[model samples]
Target: MTKQPSSLTSIASIVASMTAVAIGNGMMLAYVPFALTRSDAPDWVPGAAVTMIAFGGLVGCVIAGPMIRRVGHARAFSCSMALVILSALAIALGMHPLVWVLARGLYGASGNTNFIIAQSWLNHASANHWRGKAMALFYMAYVIGLGTGAWLFGQIPADGNLPPLVTIFFTALALLPIGLTRLPTPPAPAKVSIDIPMVWRNSPVAFIGVLAAGGLSMVVQGFTPIYAAANNVSQGDVANLMFVMQFGLIAIQYPMGTLSDRIDRRLVLIGTCLLILVAGFLALSATFSNLILLMLVFALFAGAVETVYSIANAHANDRTDPADFVPLASTMLVAWSAAATVVPLMVTVLMPVFGPRTFIYAAMAVAALYALFVLARLRKRDEVPAAERESFELKSAQMPNAGALVEAEARAE
Candidate 1:
């Protein structure tokens, strides 16, 4: 038997750390909305809070590359975890609405930074042959952590300081594995110029897929809890729903990635968009009283929408040169973040006119637009030959480290 690479060993440690922090982040994402609604805060407040987090994510993604170069991955990750702890403490102390918004934004930035560090580190460390499989494993671990967090939050009280304190405990625990791991620092990334126009010109389908996915994801993951609460679903059920949705997300990553590897990724992307449209409409029309059926619908919805980032990313890479991977990925991340930041606010506005179901309509609309774009692209360009295509790798907008890994693999090849 051959000995495994030391970089692979280090990646395992980083995965553990990432999973821990993701659990806390996932719990907070659902808990905040549920808690605020319980407090009789206005309908728009929850969606606004979610938007703040996405805005902070944009900031984090912008600075993360430079920060990682300066501090090294382990130290940068630790600093982000520490910031998360501080943000949780702020919420625990019962700050005012404005303060809570600021704290949530801080949480988003720190959490995004941590994700970037872990992803970049893993990609930097893993051998080229193992990159796709390694990233799939990382994505699976992340989804599991998120699902576990949602389920755990359901078991605890959302009122008072308990929720934030739990978040702090988990976040603090995430730091332990990082401190213990003795890993080599990755080489600093070369600075790349982001050209959004070039990226779109290269693959309009991919650009729109990511943008639509971002908008749909914020509604599904960020606003769904509030929607459930508004519809008279019990807090326990809301948590369970979130866990089910995350479970769908976790269950689909490897299968979708494997399928994309075997076929034209455009076909897979179009299928996913159709799935989102159907699921969104069904979810909107279904009576909330049928808990089991609703859970199933949401599971399908999450599974499909969550796979968009990976599929779209794979499609984009298929169309571009290997040298362009880093810049292309960076541009897409920014675009996705911008869409996520704005979509929730739109939800806030539409909720008054469309009620709690506005997010569903929003999901349907985006899915339709994305499907149209994918069809148009098919007519305009021939598919990339499978022999020339890169292996499909799973990715999440929350984890923007794949770009660095793509550049590393390109250099190796």
Candidate 2:
């Protein structure tokens, strides 16, 4: 990623990354929603199929790093696309539960690597100071993919087998850019011999913030379709419910990034977690009929937890040197992916006990727990001198203080 190649290289990387995620996430947004409202499938079957796919996805992340290194990213990523597209076509032709599991698992396992590696590539090109913005853009691509998929979700017919065929076609649509681009194969991260401990000792806020963000996002994504379905909503409404979450995803990052730049990223992070706390409460309290209100509440929650990981990234950058950023970033990305895998499995089991709204309660509880720890860790940081405090502020603040001389010139004028 640090190769400093042509702007087309950068553009290609971003486009490839975003497109891969859009199609990969297209499966995510569409899979459960389709299964939920389909005339042929039962309710629990959707959850069962998704849980297996997610588990396969979890296993996929473990091997992706080494696989990317061994075979190179382009081939690795392209193979994943082929597998996913083929699987979608198979599912489209028929309605076998086992094939649904296989398609989705292949989709999950292969889907996240391209997106993950793309971020690593983007991180390589970005300066540490601007990395927060860069990472925000990278992560936003996933949300945008999800957003686009939800809108596209309706184009799939509501009949027994048609939706899978639509999914297969769009899945192929997302692969075209990669096939056309003349981009060089991006380099993989260096293999880490050590699983460095206490890396977040100075910035516990960042450590927990990211994990919690991953947890909340995975839970909602894995199960929101189930929640909407049990409430008697249509497939389109389920798509829109996921879209509302993506809407939250796109709407929150810039302001949060700006606030992190201005004040302590830690506080911005904590404040966002608190927002999730409120959102979780509101989200859990609602009955089946209140879909619109639930959408608004979860959207607010999405803004808080989803984008806060970028702030956590900024905070992590604060304590490390330029050289360590890439390795640390790879580690953090792994950590987040690992949590994203586990969160759904744990929460899905809760659905039978707590009803389909398990994601809400679980997200709220996790957010509150992480928020409290972050605040506690931040207490020591609060005692730092005012001068020292500003030193850790985002580098963007050192510019002329929002047009300082303009006021004096206005008086002269």
Candidate 3:
């Protein structure tokens, strides 16, 4: 009989895969719309293209669980990686707007499933005590990978086949670690179902918090570069801005995560939204005028925006049974992706008519509205007992169902 690889081995493999693909994925995110804008495509195309990626993500979340159940986790992961490579190649070979849109859609589906595979694997491997830190490390890996990719974007010329070719290299590199690792895949997932009402009942704050996170985060990630470009920021500095935002996110991750463990996570969620409002106001004031100041404030804004999903996840997990983790996560992702899908398109369509600062106004409105919702929720439910609360972990905002592995363990218990 084969010996099971230790959690340490699984973690190494998972983090390695996340880091590698994130570099590629990060580059792709910036490259797609930036490329569209540079090509003098219609203003709506860049945002429309971004919306397609989000739409693809919604499709990915719906399918990833069942795909893992059908093929088994390891095989499912391999399939997603294959798609990643193929999509990147398509993007490299063709710059036609239609081809670019289709390639990005493929990348979005496959890329999101890839992360879901890794996160579910990591959660399965980690002990309860260690899961928080392990997850935080995983989050850090992507942040660093993305930061590195954005920095490289500044240095590399966008012409020719070089950008997507480089993305393909990293996507290919991601496969090596997973292929060699002996770590076991999580027991196959059960059939997937998204029960949004169940999740809303589990934690109303989490339900709304995720929507707030998704809507604001998509705007930030999808449009920040385009917004920067519209305001006359240089291409290289735009890359630097992306890098700085990631740096800000990482710097606060540990502190915010640990604090969520100590206090009412709802309170933390409220504070985070407030931070977003303040940062949005600052960013609008800066209006891409002072690159240095904008970067500084945007970092704080990004940092606050990034933490909402994780804190809300922790809050929801506190109220939920481990047995329900899989479905609860699915529901949450659906909520997130639903918001993600519509919000960017709204900003994109309005930006040309209302001007570039539209994203700032929309993001601020989201944060403000969410904060008010949390305030109402706070008056309704008492805090979960401190002892029952799960320790917090940093989670990616894009993919929702990271808790599937926890369900198997819950069943075994």
Candidate 4:
């Protein structure tokens, strides 16, 4: 009886900590790009900064498993949080483009590593019977925190250093919960080898799908402020756009996952791609003049686009061996992070020549190409049977340890 209550308390502490950092990350997501657009930096600098962040995320994934093993979860989490605060302060104080790049890199590294620690700790502490519920709660924390932060971005007066300072405050707040928790630190996450080739061999669709999902979703979330700034959108409206789009991303996850569980997951991916294409068409076809309509289309688009990572991940796990689950998780995140790194650089080159609409155009091409590829593969491979398929969970590229948790749940069952 006591075990259950204690487990719940520990899980709650982890969630609180995760939510605080996510709020800070959400603010930085909007602030960085918008600030760059207003600065004298070249058009490509925003994309470059994002690319560096992705690069740092890859670094985080590599280091997290070992870092936790060496220092334990509580200490590792604190260290990562400290790095986040440092990065935020750097961004707050620095005006140079190179400084922004370095700060964003550290931000990405710490943010990704911190999430891995939080989720892993939550997984370790959760009672097996209700682990799924704990994970669901964890998912909600991220979405709520991120959305709240974006909304706060709009609410905060942009006067002087207030915006970045508020972000620093949230990052600082994250340190208190986990740092002070009475619960014991969870065991170190086991080191798993990541192999991209193995991922491709097991599920080509998942490989490509996560890549597309990561790239598309990252661009939509990370670069939208740049697009708005380019189009002369007010800061308040830009923040509103981010809030609405994030809401859409959160709203669509379960419905799509539930629907995917009922039928072929590929079909769901196809539908999501179509939504992306439709959103792109809407954006290009004079919808920008009407803010409400534009927001609706973007909301729809974000919901569909962001859901791709989880669906693709579930699709792969359906076909993967239990022994390989950890590796699969590691590999897919690598794929996701890699695409996130490369795609922004590619898009930025075009954005400079074609203006803001180039973002929409690049997204359309990715959607069209990914949809076609999935279609081609469908003819080559039959769908995994429903009985054998893993129940879909709402997932994000940020939560790199989710697949390992899924494996643990299966073992618990």
Over 4 Å off, model 4: 1-9, 398-413
Q: lDDT score, residue 69, model 2?
A: 74
lDDT of 1 by residue, 1-413 (tens): 12335544547788888788878887887788887766666767777788888888888877777777787777878888988998888888983666777888898788778776777766666767776677778887898888788888888877778878888888888888888876666666666457789888889888888888778887788888888877778878988898888877656756887788888888888888888888998898888899889988998888888788778888888888877877887788777878888887798888888887888888888888888888888888888898888777767655543354223443444
In terms of lDDT, model 2 sits at: 0.60
Expressed as tens digits, the lDDT of each residue in 1-413 for candidate 4 is 12333445557778888888878877888778878888899878988887788888878877877788898888988999889888888877866888998889998798778877777766666777667778878877887788778778888865456777888898889889887787656555677577777788889999899889878877777777888877878778878887788778677777988999999999999888898898888877744468888788788878888778889988998988877777888787777878887887788787778887776787888889999999999998899999999888777654544334222443433
Model 3 C-alpha lDDT per residue in residues 1-413, reported as the tens digit of each score? 22334455457877998799888887877777677777767777778777778777877886887788888777888899888888888878867887777777887788778877887777667766566677778877888898888877778887777778889899889888888877766677666667777788889898888888888888887788777766666768888998898877766656887888888888888888888899998987885657899898988888888888878888888998877777787777777877888898899889888887788899999989988899898889999988999777667675454554344553333
**Candidate 1 Cα lDDT to native:** 0.78
Over 4 Å off in model 1, which ranges? Answer: 1-7, 397-413
Query: For model 1, where is the 10-residue window of minimal lDDT?
Result: 401-410
Clashing pairs in 3: none
Write the residue-wise lDDT of candidate 2 on 1-413 in tens digits.
22444343454555554555574465445555456445366545666655665555555556666777787766766776677677677677667766776677776666555554554445444544554455445455555666777766755555566655666665666567756655555555456322346447645666666566667666666666766766777777777777787767556656776767677676777787778887777877876577798778767777666666666766766765545544455556556656665776677566678877777888888877887887787767753333343222221100001111011111121
| Candidate 1 lDDT for residue 58 | 80
- If both were scored by lDDT, which would come out higher, candidate 1 or candidate 3? 3
* Cα lDDT computed for each candidate against the true fold: 0.78, 0.60, 0.79, 0.79
TM-score of each: 0.94, 0.81, 0.93, 0.94
Residue 339 shift from truth in candidate 1, angstroms: 1.1
Worst 10 residues of 2 by lDDT: 396-405
RMSD of each: 2.6, 8.7, 2.1, 2.3
